[model samples]
Target: MPRTDTASRVITAPLDRVWDALVDPAALAVWLPPAGMTGRFERFDARPGGSYRLVLTYADASGAPGKATADSDIVEARFVDIVPGVRVVQAVDFVSDDPANAGTMTMTWQVTAVAAGTRVDIVATDVPDGITAEDHAEGLASSLANLAAHTER
Candidate 1:
């Protein structure tokens, strides 16, 4: 069986603003990587059947160069479902030579208006065996944190 993970966070921004940030390609480059990393989007099309690609690189805690061996991860994804200001679902697969990580995963992002702000829920399914549940959860939460900070600014 494939692994599955779910995480949610509340961004201090309005639903519409968050939605725009999430769907925009340039905006995604600003806040998509997890802690201690940076991201660059090569292509991003936010409509159903459209696709996107991104590169994420790792750095040290001191923000200095060196130390980490696994320098980057490449992700290619497709937008499967998109509901303006409401939800975005995607199918993802990593570009890797390792057979252990070979597989496609589906992630659903739900955005809803809340009293405090906008609630963002993430659900990922069919995760490859190489990715642990805990690690994937942290990555998801970290991404939400990044989004919150970006939208709040």
Candidate 2:
């Protein structure tokens, strides 16, 4: 069965800034941490049919080095729906070298402005069977926290 993971965080930043950080390669590289991880965007169209690819490198918690890279060579992402600074729905897929995980996944990122800050919600489906949901959740939350710090600075 496919697993789903969701995580959310409130960033002390404006929606526009958050949105920029989400799409900008340089900005994304600043955040999204597994510690010592960097992201390289091959192609980011941001619109429907646009493609995106990112590389992440970091050390495992046990002090071992590892990488979690993904390439959406032909993204089917689209602005299926939008609410200005409120929310956005896009289709996301990941292509990995691992044979166990070679398929498309749909991911949606929702942003909502609150009195304290902007609440960013991320939902990912079709996670590989071997990977645990909790691990994905923690990774996403960690990334979000890193993003919050990056934007706050």
Candidate 3:
């Protein structure tokens, strides 16, 4: 079966707050990066057909990151769909020299209102062969945790 890594969590924030984090570049910059990495948007246009660029760099000098040996990862992404307060879909391509990592991937973020809070779901499809599923999942989880911590305060 084709690889699709998925994760879900219930955030204490409301749907609007969660949605704001998805669309607001400033909020995203705070929580989108994984544990040790940090993210900054090169260019972000949230509308459909708009393209975005993000650079994820290591927080520490150590080269090994879970499963890959790279100081950073740069992705060129396009917004496929955006439903405010509901869903977002992005088509992304990583800039890499390796043949295994040269491919387009899709990432979907969904937000649903739950009893306790908002349920956030992320699904990544067509993940690069250079990145293992476990690593990707960890990164996603870390981002979610960051988001949770960010809005909670």
Candidate 4:
């Protein structure tokens, strides 16, 4: 069966600023990759039905080979829904030949106003079996920290 994973954080920034970081491609390129990864967007369009291709490269490739390549994970994603300042939903698939990584995952990013700032919540569903829960959790938390840093500045 497919799995779902979630992570959330309270960013000490206004909701609008946080929302802007979510939509901005440049900001995403800086914040979307996890701790040991660097990412670049090949193409990006942030409207409903639009799509983007993101390539993430591992800083160290001594472990298992990446989903797409020896050191890279390529994601092809489509914007499924965009609710300005509230939420963004995407349908994502990894560009890989491995059967374990072949599937469409739905990722939802939601922000809510909180007492200290904005609470950003991310939920990923139908995660491919190749991605372990522990790794996904760490990646999500790392991305959230990156997002907080990007928007708080």
Among the numbered candidates, top TM-score falls to 4
| lDDT (Cα, tens digit) per residue for candidate 3, span 27-47 | 998999888888889899999
Would you give me the overall lDDT of model 2? 0.63
Sorted by TM-score (best first), the order is: 4, 3, 1, 2
- Tell me the lDDT of candidate 3: 0.86
Task: Please report the candidate that would top lDDT against the real structure.
Answer: 4
Local distance difference test, each candidate: 0.85, 0.63, 0.86, 0.96
TM-score of each: 0.90, 0.76, 0.93, 0.98
Candidate 4 per-residue lDDT over residues 60-132, each given as its tens digit: 9787578999999999999999999999999999999999999999999999999999999999999999999
Error of 1 at 62 (Å): 14
> What's the number of clashes in each of the models?
0, 0, 0, 0
Q: Score residue 112 of candidate 3 by CA lDDT.
A: 98
| Model 4 lowest lDDT segment of ten | 60-69
* Model 3 lDDT-worst window of ten: 61-70
The pairs that clash in candidate 4 are none
Candidate 4 at residue 32, lDDT? 95
